[model samples]
Target: MSAKFEVYLDHSGQHRFRLKAANGEIIAVGEGYTTKSACLQGIESVKANAAGASVVETDD
Candidate 1:
């Protein structure tokens, strides 16, 4: 009923932020950030712009 947030580090150690559905399928892969905080900010920004989505991190 609500969106979820997930975060991970890429092969380059950068942050990878993604939004997905509850079914474990990706909805959107946001631009990579140089820092975790930056990625988190991106997630927040995405969530503010969307709804009923989940965020996740993926390997590079």
Candidate 2:
């Protein structure tokens, strides 16, 4: 088993996605999108941009 992305509708009927680990724990979530296609695009953008993403610490 490996990590995977799942797309589903929210309580407000908006399209959203979540990335789940093999253990079935959600590691990440995407914001709601008006259309399913846009939600999927958001996933692709994460795939394309996150591989080399930097980690930064910020103070709030």
Could you give the C-alpha RMSD of every candidate to the true structure, in order shown? Answer: 8.4, 0.5
Candidate number achieving the greatest TM-score relative to the actual structure: 2
Worst 10 residues of 2 by lDDT: 51-60
TM-score for each model: 0.69, 0.97
What is candidate 2's lDDT per residue for 13-54, written digit by digit as tens?
A: 999999999999999999999999999999999999999999
Segments in model 2 whose C-alpha atoms lie over 4 Å from true places: none
| Alpha-carbon deviation at 32 in model 1, angstroms | 1.1
The reply for model 1, stretches above 4 Å from the true place, is: 1-3, 51-60
The window of 10 residues in a row where model 1 has the poorest summed lDDT is: 1-10
lDDT of 1 by residue, 1-60 (tens): 444567888888889877668877887787779988999989888767767657889997
lDDT for model 2, on a 0 to 1 scale?
0.98
Superposing every Cα of model 2 onto the true structure, what RMSD results?
0.5
lDDT of each: 0.79, 0.98
